[model samples]
Structure formats: structure tokens, C-alpha cells
Target chain A: MRADYLILGNSAAGVSAAEAIRATDSCGSIVIASPEPHRVYGRPLISYLLEGKTSLERIGYKNADFYERLNIEPFLGPGYDAMRLDANAHRATFSNGTEIEYGRCLIATGSIPFTPPIEGLDEAQNVTPFLTLDNALKAQELADRARAAAHAEGRESRAIVIGAGLIGLKAAEAISHSVDRVMVLELAPRILPAVLDAEGARLLQGMLARHGIECRPGVSAQKILVDGGTAHGALLTDGTEEPCDFIVAAVGVRPNTAFAVEAGATQGRGLVCGPDLQTSLPDVYAAGDVVQVRDALDGTERPLALWPNAVRQGMIAGRHMADDPLAPVFDGSFAVNAVDFFEASLLTAGLINPPDNAEGVTCDVRIDEAAGTYAKFVVRDGKLAGYILLNRPDNAGIYTWLIEHETQLDTIDPALFDSAPLNCDFDKTMRWERLHAGYPADRNEKGFLVKRECPSAS
Target chain B: MKRIYAIEAWCLGCKRCEIACKTQHSATRDTVKALTQEQPSPTSRVQVEGDRFLSLAVNCRHCAQPKCVKGCISGAMQKDPASGLVTSDPAKCVGCRTCVSMCPFGCVQVVSVEGRDIALKCDLCTEDGCIPGEPACVAACPNGALVYWESEE
Candidate 1:
């Protein structure tokens, strides 16, 4: 098939690209290829699937006729796989021996779970990874099976979740509600090592403990021991064999950019895409997890696999590919993950890493272990550099806006942070200023006077 | 050229004007059945005051650039071609509530009564059969709160 714009991958990045293309060029011929069997489903809601809070049908991001309404051809597949991107020919070859030609193409292939090799890992039957909807369903099945087995035998069930990252912790929480015991094993010194600092992680560890899930830090699974063709237990690096009914691998993921490499697009940490998401080839572009774009804050190029970034990048790339270029909406992508784990909300933005030379920088932090609230702010050059708000997140929105808008310290009273809600009501003028920023017209139009109308005026 | 006017002052808290609006718009031609029947009572396009204690009537202002009509996703809300009044067809509305959320004045109320979502607001009761020169609200108001007048040059 030939089209004006050919898009690969059908999740956030791919679908957003399709919408952007249609918005820019209404009549352009578009062909989208997806490896997944169904419509785009919100990835964030996949976690809620474990608790039976939602069903597969409720999770669809777009409706059934979304593609039809957009006037785009959807090569949605259970089998349609993109094997190679022939950039020179402006075509892609699928594993099923189907070739699609395009005017311009985008690679939003997203990412796949990076399951590291452990001893006897292949023999495990119920080993599941929490990445796709299928994986979530399969993990739920295994969890239910283990629970049923325990109930039948009048015994307690155990579920081992490897990697105490976002996915691992969430999965462990979900399983803990149904199973007898859920243990989260993390190799890092602290849980949520990448996103949260030591103090933040400690707070989260306590929260998880309250939820009845065992949070183990600085412990690595050395091997998975199978007995009778089933995963019997796992051996920790510390020489401990913990008996478990099922194992969930939520270690992490790497960008799926093999197609980019095969297509001869310049590859480094990921497919090297310009600010426009364009690859080395003329008509080819890469986005989402598979492409490395410069970070706006530090200028360091990183693979941003976050769903929000992917959607923004894909939309920008799609509009550019449609021959209607707007000012590149996404220069690179900001890194922000707002997650709620077992009712404890966590919002982390920017790099948590402080500069090596912290001599001149001033950091203010307040930690309330009892309330499970942790707030930290780094002020560099009189501007907010990084922020971390956990549990008690009422001020999260204000802090996030400050970080995004680069609000200076001069405008804010240092005492405003003292209030639990971050309200500036203590200072009338400051409160008015903050409220005016949110609604400019109300103050500007009305001023400090009320107009009086006579009864006959109506 | 009768102008739709809302009385901000001397307005009673009762929603009789809203009821009168539904009575005028209902195809049933009977007020008792329309008011008492549980199944799909005719919805007045008018909304009672959002702030309950200090009550006021909220209706479309019929602005030059009506935001409710502009914000409608399914093209259900539209300005009358000749009358220049912002109106919505219940048939075309998919009940997305985008208009309700977007309206700055909180003039639109999206109520899910009888298991179907619909927007309620005031349409001046223009289509409701009227006598030669009087609006239903102006006549119904015991305190003479609502007034209808034409703009004079």
C-alpha cells in the first residue's frame, strides 16, 4: 500500500500523529501500521485492570470507528510486523512479506520490557511482564490461579514481583489485595531509585509496608528455580530461596529501535532524531521511546518513553510529515511521571540529580514521615531547578506550574510553602496576584467597582 | 425585536420561570402530566443559579460570538440564523458536556435525568406560543423581576 504519510506503532505516539496529520492536512492519504491487535488503549489504566476496577472495553483510548472517521487506513494487526525500514525506497517491509510505500514515515514503535537473563528463567511457566494489556491479563490469570490453588489447598499464596520500580511496585500492590503475600524485590539501594531520592523512597517504602506488601531493597534475584515444570521459588543474591507461586518481571524497558538500525538511520542511545523528529534519511522520522531527543533543561539527549512525551512528539512529527509545518510544538520532551500507587500519589519532575558542586545551591525540604508527605525543592540561580512532592500533593500543581513556567523566587513569598494547601491567603496582595494569574479577565474587567443599574434599565 | 432580559435584582428563588419554559416547549400540551410524569420531563434550556443561596436565572446572552454554540463538539448548539439567539437541538446533542464545562458564566447545566444526559439553559421562550407582546417570565414573575424589551435606536 502507498500513502502520503505512513505511521508505525499504534499507541499514544502513533495515534496522536494520525490526529495531527488530519488536523493539518484533511485530505492526505494516511496508512498506519500497528503490531497490536486492537485500538489504542490508555497504557496508564492497564494497572487498574489487575483489581477488576475496569475492563478492557473501558480502557480503549479511541472508539472503534476512530480511524474510519479520520479517513485513514489502519493496518491494525495481530500479525502485521514491521521488519525493516527501507528509508531510501521510502517503504517498510513487514515480516508477513507485505511492503508499504509512503511519502513520509514515522517510527513510533515505543518500547518493550527489558527482561534480564537469570539462571533457569526459561523453564518458568507463569513468568509475566507488566508492559502490554496482554501481559497484564496474563499476569491477572496467573495471580487468580495461584489464589484458587491456595484456597483449594487451604494455604496462603505468595507472589514475587521483581524490580521495585513504578510498574513493579504497582503490580505488587495490585496482587497483594488478592493474594496471600506479595513481595517486591529491588536490586537498587532504594526503591524508585531513578525517580525518588533516598528520603522519598524511604517514605514510599513505609507506605508500601502499610499496604501489607513486603518491600525489599538492595536484594537481587540471582536465579529462578523451577520444579515440575513450574516456577517453585527464586534465589536471591544474598543466598535466600523465597518460595513463590508466580513471578512478575517489571525490571524496565529499552527502546525498540531495531527497525531504525536495519534501515540505516543514525543510532546511538536511540534513533538520533532532530528537533523535528526527523532521522538521517529524508522522509523518515522516529519518535517515542525509540528516538533520543535533547532534553530542554540540561540539553542531554535521553530516550523519553513516558506516554505524555510520546503523544506530544508523535503529534509534532505527524504535523511535520503532513507537509504543513507549524512551529515545532515539542522541542524535546519534559520528563514527568505522576503516579498513584495504592492511594499514595507521587509526582516527580526534572532530574533529581543535584549538580556535583552544590556549594552555591540552596535546597529546602520538609519530610513528615507520619503523614507520608515529602516535599523537596532545589533553588538554583533564584529559580526552581527541580521539585519532588509525594503523598500530600496539594501544592503539586503550583510547584509543577512554577517548574514549567520557570517562575522566579522574587514573585513568591517563601512563607507560602508553609500552608498545607499552598494558599497565599495570609498575604492579601499576593493572593490576589496568584488568583489574577489564573483568571486575568475577572480582575481586569471588573476592577474595584460595581456598576449600579436602575430598575427601569431592564 | 423583543429583547431577552434577566433581572439580577428582586428575583425570587423559585424556578417557576424554568417550569414555565418547559411547559411552553413541551409537545404534550398538558402541564400536569409534563410536571408530574417521571419519564423524560421536558427540560427547560434555563438553569437555576449555580450558587444556591443567592439565586439568579442563567440564560444564553445571545452574544455576537456565543461561546456555547462555538464550544459544541457535535454542532448541536447553534445560533438561530434569523433570530440571532443561541439555541441547541436535543436530537443532535451527544451529551459530551464539553459546552457545560467550557461556558465561562456556568450558564449551561448538564443533568443526567432519566438515564440520558442533556444540557439545560434559557432560550427566552421565543418558540413557546405567546400573546401579542409579553414574555412568559415577565408575566409569571409576581415581583415583576424579569423584563422583556426591544433595543431602541
Candidate 2:
């Protein structure tokens, strides 16, 4: 088989690129294949699905008629998982023993869960990685069993989750809804070490405590204790024995880069791609969590593994694939995320923690213990480097914009940091250019907006 | 295509546009009931920032590359390819507020209604009391502060 544009992985990156391609080359004969047995759903909202905040259907990232209306053919389910890539041949081999030659290809096969070794972990029952839709289904079944056990045995069932990062805690929160108890174990000194600072994590920990979700930092599961083929409990490294009905292996994730790397895409922390999002291999591009982007803050290249970055990269790669001339350069990325646990919301961006003994870096924090609000900003070399806004939602992105633009501190108002930023905070000229005078939403010839999906509009 | 442009110099900051916006989007579409009776009182999509002394009414720019649309995790936010209008579907939004943090102009917001949290943003008065092509804010603006027009804007 052959396709003009062959896309692997149908999540954020691949789907975005397909939309972009459809917008540019209306009759490109696009082909998308993924291992998942469903349409493109929001991977970030899988926890929300477990929590009953969203449903299976509503979690879909696009309309039900998305693939149909767009005129792209999709090959879904485990049979379609790409097994090998021959970049030189411009061909890909799938698990179902089929090979497809393509004019151009995009490998967006995202991340894979990385589970740390634990004694007797494989013997444990009801252990699952919370990554894909299928895993969520398994967790939902686990939640149901625990709920049944709560009703029958009269002893509460607990969950032992390993890790205190974003994914682990979210899984804990979702499991907490049905399960009687959830205990999160993290090896770091504070929860959410990747996104929040010490104080911000402390504030978030307090919030989690109120929800009856116990978080144990500086600890990890040393062994998975099994009783008659089922997970009975876990033994912590700190010599604490805890009982549990299930275990969640939520350690972390590594990029799924085996195919790309073996096919000679130039490997680093992730697949190395340039501003056009194309790997060194000719006509082969990569995006989403599987690729690394240059850090806008520290100038280090690392996998951002964020949704917005994937979507943006996908658009750029699609434009490059379709030859959309006005595609914007991939300007690199910083750590920007917004997540909610129960009623608490956390917003973080850029370099939350400066390196040790870093010169010309200043950290400023304002705390209101009573309100459970903590706002910290890190500045380096007289430019906005990063910020953490805990329980402060108003105009948080303006700080993100400042970090992205590397705005000089002297030009900004001192009072702006004291409160919610407004458009008036900027001088008239800047305000007019950035705020009042909005970008024309439909000027097709401008920028990467030249996707040809709406042929009638053009 | 027509779009709303803020004329800051002609601004009175009277907040009439804000009130008009809230009423237009409210369930009752009546100023008194919309403010006092609604379970979750509608917020003004068009905000008059600063004060009467010096302020600018800010709303969604509906940018060509809308960060909210791109950053939305649940696919709740969408930009219509035909109309060029960026709108939020309250049903699909998980109230993650990712879009709220992605809007550089500070336009998108989260509001609670009927015991559910969803994103709230300006839909150019499409759902409520839209006056032909003009949005409620522009039609209700006392001055020419907010203009909804076309031809090189």
C-alpha cells in the first residue's frame, strides 16, 4: 500500500498534523495508523474519565465525524502499531505484517510508561500502568472490584501508587473517588518535584491531605507483597508494611523511540529534530512526546512531553510535509502545565528552580498561608525565567508570555506582579499591538493558517 | 471578515458593555434577573479593565493561531474554519483550565453552572442575543469604544 502522507500514532501530534495537512493539501491521500482501538481521544483526560468528570465518548479530541469529514483514512487497533521503519526506503512495517510505502512520514508514536523494578511485582494482580484508554478500562475494573469489596467485606480497600508526579497523583485522585483509600509514594523530597517548588508542593500536599489522600515523599515501594496471586499489600523501603487491593506503577515515562532511533533518526534524550520538526533522516519527521525540543529557558534539549508543544510541532511538521511556506519556526519550549486535583488548581511554567549558585538569578515569592496561595517567580539575567502560580489563576498566561518572549524586567510594571495583570499594564503601543489589535482569525495566506480543509472558505 | 476592535481613547469605562454582555449571555436575558436570580450569574465576556479614569474593554481576539484552541486538552475549544470564530463547547470541557492559562490575552475563563465546571469565553454573541453580525458589546457600547466592522478592520 502507499500513501502521500503516512502518519504513525493518532494522538495529539499525529492528529494535529493530519488536520494541518488536510488544510494545505486537500487531496493528499492521508493515512493514519495507531495501536489504540478507538478514535483520537484526549490522553490527558483519561484520569478525568476514571473520575466521572468526562465520559469515553466526550473525551474524543475531535468531532465524531472528524476523520470522515476530513477525508483521511485511519487504521486503528493493535494490528496497526508500526513495528519497523525503513527511512531509506520511505516505508513502514506494522504489527499485522503489512508494509506501507509513503511519499512522506510522521512518527508521533508518543511515550511509554517506565516502571521501576520492584521485588515480586510481576506476581501481583490488578497492577496496571495508567497510560492509555485500555489501561483506564483496567483501572475502572479495579475500581469496581474495590467498590464491591468495600460493600461486601466491610474493610476498606486501599491503593498503593508509586510516584508523586503529575500522572501518579492524578491517578490517585481518580482512584480516590471510588476506592476507600489511596497512598502515594514518591522518592523525591516533595510531591510534584517536576512542576512545583518546595513551598508550592507543600501547599498542594496540604490540599491533598484534606481530601484524605495521604502522600509520602522520600519513600518508595521496596517490594510488592502478594497473597495467593493477588496483590495483598506492599513493603516500603522505610520498612512500613501497607495493605492494598491494587498497585499502580506510575513511576514515569520514556519516549517510544525504538523504531525512529533504529531507523537512524539521530537519538538524544528523544528523537532529534530541527526547527522544521524533521529528523536527520530524509522525508521522515517526528513530533509529540517522542521528540525533544530545545528548552527556551536553559537552552538544553529535552523532551517537553506537553500537549501544546505536540500540537504546535505537529502543525509545523504537517506544514513542512505539505510545503506550507509560512510555517513558523519551532521556537523551542519551557515546562508549562496546568492541572487540577480535586478543588485545587496548580499552574506552573518555565524554570521553577534555578541551578545551584546560578549568578544573576533572583527568586521572589509571595505567600498567604490562610488562603493557601503561593506565587513564586524566578528571574535570571534581568529577564523573566519562570514562575509558579499556586491557587492563582488570573492572568497566569501573561507570565508565560513574558517567559516565552524573554521580556526585560525594566519595561514591566512592578505593580503587575503584585496583582492580576491586565492589558492596560502594557504601554499603549504594546497593548494595541498584542491585545486590542487582534490577529485576523481567518486570513488564510498569513502564517500556518493556510490549511486547505475549508476549501470553500478560500 | 468583521471583528471587534477596541478604541481605548474613546472609552468612558462606564461598564455598560460589560452589563450588556452579561445580560445577553444569561439564561433570562433580563438585566435584573440575570444579575440577581441566576444560579451562576453570567460573567461579562467583555471586561472593562482598569477603571473609569483609564481603562480598555478586552475580549477574545479570536486569533488566527488561538492558543486556547491549541492548548485545549478535551477538544472543547474550537475555531470554526468557515466563520473564523473561536468558541468553547461547555459539554466536552473537563474544566482543566489549561485553556485559561494558554490565552496570553487573558480572555478565556472558567465558570461554574448547574453544578458543573466548564470554560466560558466570548462566542461573538452567537449563542445569545446576537444582533446580525455585530456582537452585543459593540451594539450596547455607549461610545464608539468597541467597533465591530470590516474592510481592513
Quality of candidate 1's docking, in CAPRI categories?
incorrect
Best by DockQ: 2
Considering only chain B, report the TM-score of model 2. 0.92
TM-score of each: 0.72, 0.94
For model 1, the stretches where C-alpha displacement exceeds 4 angstroms are A355-359, A420-458, B1-153
lDDT of each: 0.70, 0.86
Q: Residue-pair clashes per candidate, as listed?
A: 4, 4
Q: Estimate, for each residue in B1-153, the C-alpha lDDT of model 1 and write its tens digit.
A: 344444434556587777776776576846777788735677765544423434455445555545455345334566664666566555445444445433434455555555545565656665532222345655666654455555220
lDDT tens digits, residue span A64-166, model 1: 6889999989887865678988888888988788899989999888888888888866678888988888888888888899999988989889899999998
- The per-residue C-alpha lDDT of model 2 at residue A113 equals 92
DockQ values per model: 0.04, 0.51
Return the DockQ of model 2: 0.51
- Model 1 DockQ reads 0.04
- Evaluated at residue A318, the lDDT of candidate 2 is 93
